[model samples]
Target chain A: MVRVAAHNIISPLGCTSQENFDKVVAGQSGIALRKKGELSDTDFQAALLNMEVLKDKISGIANAEAYTKLEQLCILSLNEVLDGVDVKSERTGFIFSTTKGNITEITNNPHAVDALLATTANKIANYFGFKSSPQVISNACISGLAAFVIGRRYIDAGKYDNVIILGADILSKFIVSGFQSFQSLSPEPCKPFDANRDGLTLGEGVASVVLSKADNTNKACVEVVSGAISNDANHISGPSRTGEGLYRAITRTVGANEEVDCICAHGTATPYNDDMESHAISRAGYETIPVSGLKGYFGHTLGAAGVIESIISILAMQNNVVIGTKGTVEQGVVAPVNVTKENIQKPVNGLLKLMSGFGGCNAAVYFKKHGE
Target chain B: MVAMLLFILKSMENNQIIKEVSIEHGKVLINQSEFFTGETSDLGPFLKSLYKQLNLKYNKYFKMDHLSKLGFLASEVLLLNEGIANETDEVAIILANASSSLHTDVKYQESIADIPSPSVFVYTLPNIVIGEISIRNKFYGEHMFFVQPSYNKEELLDYTTCLFNSTPCKYAIVGWVEVNRNGDYSAKLMLCQNKK
Candidate 1:
């Protein structure tokens, strides 16, 4: 089985997975209201990384100024997870996931090659001196989880013994302005699944996880049992009212008789998204499972949401706790779900991560504690 | 392992190339036969003329950015050549490209100078083409969009094999679709199905 060997998260909350988990478990939020004329004329609510701190972290690397902020964040997260890992081996592969990489570069020159997602991925992969060509997944918001699915399959197919997956996207005027055009940005911090939930808040982050085929039967680890991707065929920008795609993806990933102890949902806190997730969870018979959305803390990290949230879920499983939905106050949706509002101390052996994106794409990854 | 074997066997049994379509250099090819040829300088007029020649009535085609239009046209021709009415919703779309949506991203970036056009802003994502195709074909199955420096058929085929083995996907439209601001573009799509 494909298993997680190590993971890291670099966000506003902290640099390492454990650090972010501790802050999140303490109910500390990284989100704040800010007015940056370069990003938007009006004040916006988002979870932004402290640039000075990030600069200090990036300063340790050689020729750090040459790399973009997004690339620097990716390097930082990947470095934390690559301790003693053989990334130079021919059997090791790299996969980068992002919605937009260096998108702000386009503001300077629309034709800038650095603005291309593939270019950014290649630059980072080459920086790590990886032997093989890096693969990139850019399927909107689901890119992070989809990368895991692809990595697991590659290992299962004997194409690689290990795969390093990195998902990163930095906030920019290009991104914020686009959301502002759609008016999807909430004036306040997002309240996912809450009756008063208005809209989603944008955030930036980078996350990394190493998947390996080496068995760790005696040790505590998380195994990727299965994963599936499905399209809603409903709308490009809006989620399906019926939640058809997400429901099918969940059922396909979990299959029959596999227990899922908790769910890490793609709760962007948008009314349509949260409602759609509730319906999908209920339809898949997982309504009673302890479910929570991490966007409140991370402010919808887009491409980083899946990997960062998945790593946090794995941490929760390891610690035997269910992290609460940060900004949610009262349960509100068309269907019923056991949304965890406060940290619950319990054994979480199985976790299912769900993400839906702009392409009518929905992905689910089921992970189980090794030897559970 | 058994699923992988099943996938291999299935490929050997019925994964025939049903239809192939390629659009590049102001020309369209079906199974390597020229279907349409136009001016290569600008893709806008060429795409519009091709749409007219194909007698497609989908108005949404005009709204898509160049990348999606390229992919959409390729898919439309591929499915049209297959001569089937989308028998199943399990048709998967596995697409890869180098430029992603940079062609349209550039345009959207230009629009940001004025007012961010919500219509144009929505198509900035690479996977929006997949969504457009899904909406057009009513396909409610698995789909993924990959970005590489160039087309890597072997990797895409491997991922498609895994999908066929692990999920309920019965067919797939896989290939490369790329577009850039310089009007350099290409779309080569093939339809494959696991025949019973």
Candidate 2:
């Protein structure tokens, strides 16, 4: 089994996984209205990281100024999770996940070589003297979770003893304007799975997780049991009304007799996504499982959503508490799902992390506490 | 002993390359034979002419970005008479490219100078090509997009092998589809299935 050895999350809520989790348990959010003319002409609500603080945190890294903001954040998070791991070992693998890497570099010059996802990924991989070329996953929003799946496969194939997955995406005029054109951004903090939910609030974050094959017999850890990805085959930009792909993914990951403690849903707060997730959950016979969405706190951090939310949910499991869906006031989905409105103290062990993206792509991952 | 036997079975299943299609420099090749060739180097008109030549009824082809058009046409030509659409739900799509929609991303960025067009904005992501193919063919199986410096056959093959062994993936459309801002494009897709 692929075990998560260490992880780090750099979101607006906090810098580390524990910090972000503490803030979520206390019912705090990083989203706020901003008048950043660089990102948008008008005011917008999003969970934006403090660039100044980030620069200070990553200042000690060599030639940090040469890297883009997203790359800096990635370096920071990866550094935190490395923890003396032998990154240069031939058996260690690196995977970079991002929907758009250094996309802001193309705002003025579209021909910038650094704007290429592969180039940025290579730069990050080269920083720590990785022996092999990094595998890059740019599969839209599901990229992060897909990276984990690939990492696990590498370890399972005996090709690598450890794999580091780093996922990050930053907010820019390019991204904000595109979502604005789609009219997908919410004017206020997103209220996921709520009756009054209108749209998603875009956010920026960087997350890193280290998956190792080494057995840690002394401590409890989270094991990635299984993962499955499927396509809706419905529409490129719209959620499937039947949630066929999500249902298939969920069923493929979890067995009929397996008991799930909680579900971390990709609740973008867009009317169709939350409703479709509810349908998929109920269709998979998981309607009674307590479900919560971290978008209400993290504001839908695009590529980082999968890894960031997975880390938070796993932390919740370790704490033996199911964190509430922060902004969900009245659960208003088509299918009846046990949407948690407040933190519930429970014996959390198994977790089902779900995410769906713009490319009609949906992914589900099942994680169980080791030795549970 | 069981693991060794399973490994041998998987290796045996990986030998079959059912079909292959490649689009490069205004030429379309199906299974190493020239299917269509265009005289012009411009991508938009070349793709349009090829679409008409293929007698395709899908109108959405006109709306796709250059990257998506290349991938969509390659998959269309690759699976033309294959009848794999009957088992559409198990067909996986694993595509990689050097340029991740930078051709359209440049166009979308230019539109931001005026007004961001949602139509242009939606195609900025590289995986939109997979979405287009999935929509047209209704292949709801496993799908993923990778961005590599160049076409790495081993990576695609390794991942496809994993899917076939782990998931319900019976067939996969895998290859490299890339389009740059200068109208340069290349797409090489292979239809593969586990013979077992």
Candidate 3:
């Protein structure tokens, strides 16, 4: 692994646009009762954030598309995250994670090729002039978390010692249409793991982390201890009805010296997804671990999920608290898996985070307090 | 100074110079598949079989999704058949070229213009091919994809080596893959190793 500094996190919560997240964490769900796109109030209770707000709060981004919504988010975040840091001298690198990348960029520009979607990270590295090779990781919803895992490994490898892990995506007509068409979008705020849970609400946002070799002076720092990524491979788009991916991610992530007292999951509240996750969590044997899902709070960021949620998990572990499952109630998915409702108070020396995406991609991460 | 440790290899049954290290050529295109078949690792045997079933040669290579197909083929040839090693640190797949995947991208995007299809939406991103490769090959190095108008050695090396040096990986898959409307797509790769 390359040498690296501690990781820092920024979110719609305390970092930047956190006010919105605070409201959700306070037990107020964002899923509105109105209708747009393909969602109806009867199908899914909806929770969504305002894109105008998302656009307003972002730094150094113009909502432009050099390649896709995902590619732009990376630039906007990197410009800010690396503002004080030097990638040129440090040869800082990037590891990008997204389940779905900038699929929208191709349409506006006719004559596009398939390779364009796969080149998002390359565009950023080339634009910023960072020579350290950049890499991409996609493991369904866990894609972002995998990116962070790679960043840490770079440090462990005695490489440049600094890496930028970025997770981002804009809800394109492409993704929204697909889910809505699939009848996966909730009409109201998404009720994750709730007995009345209908479906998920899709939203857009980009989150970033700069993992460096040296100690960063930033207050919002967390050290990643261990992580695991696995594929259920049972189904393509549909998650293993058995939650096999979730179980493996958890089982694979537990390290001997590390302990996970809490978990953050890909609780999209979709009927099938919720049920599969419930079974998977039980199998992981962490029935009592405090669990939460950002989907209720942030909606599903799709391609940007892994990195965005991993940063959120790092923040939760670093703060020693578990954010509520914002819109959860009644335990719709299953029991045993302790879904957090109220912001729980605890001394979290370690934490676990997990996500599963299409293609049976699943991943888990374990974080612990770094030495001062 | 950096003039050291170049290996002389004659390691295959054919003694066909299976591996050779040189900065002189710096870039070479090797086929991981058999001499004629364009098989690859990322898409696995399924895609290889798919190609074979269609009797697809390089003729349709351009017509297929550029990122998906190029990722499978380029990665195989670029990795020198070693496949992505577990020891790699911060590996990024950086490709430079003139036209990005304009054709395939536009078609996929239009299908989901009103609403995206989940299957087609997966490959919409410019760097997704690399992600697919990294995910399948388990290459957790740095993940990045870039589009340049053309190849420039100094700029390419400056950007590429700095990327290699930024991470711990001694080797990197750096190159360009582009598709022409005439159903022509070509790729060039370098297995970059850092100087001690």
Residue runs of model 3 more than 4 Å from their true location after superposition: A1-24, A28-76, A99-102, A112-129, A138-140, A214-221, A370-372, B1-105, B113-196
Residue lDDT tens for model 1, A1-372? 899999999999999899999999999988999986878878999899997887777898779988888888888888888887777777788999999888888887877888888889888887888887888999999999998888998888666788999999888888999999999999999999999999999998999999999666777789888898888887889999989989988887896888899999999988999999999999998879999899999998989889999999999999899999998899899998999999999999989999999979999999999654
Error of 1 at A1 (Å): 0.3
Write the residue-wise lDDT of candidate 1 on B1-196 in tens digits: 4554554454455455677899988899999999889855368888888888789999788888888888998888888846555524579999999888887788888888789988888898999999999888888888899998888876777677767666677889999999877878989998877564
Cα error, residue B58 of model 2, in Å, equals 1.0
Q: Which has the better TM-score: candidate 1, or candidate 2? A: 2
Per-residue lDDT, model 2, residue A196, is 92
Instruction: List chain A TM-scores, every candidate, in order.
Output: 0.98, 0.98, 0.83
Kindly state the number of residue pairs that clash in model 3: 87
Cα shift from native, residue B127, model 1 (Å): 0.4
Which 10 consecutive positions of candidate 2 chain A have the poorest summed lDDT? A213-222
The C-alpha RMSD in Å for every predicted model, in order, reads 2.6, 2.4, 8.2
* Ranked by DockQ, top first: 2, 1, 3
Chain B TM-score (each prediction, in order): 0.88, 0.91, 0.62
Which whole-number lDDT from 0 to 100 does residue B40 have in model 1? 50
Which stretches in model 2 have alpha-carbon errors above 4 Å?
A: A214-219, B1-15
lDDT of 2 by residue, B68-156 (tens): 88899888899999877543568889999998989888888888978899998889899999999998888878889999999998778
TM-score of 1: 0.95
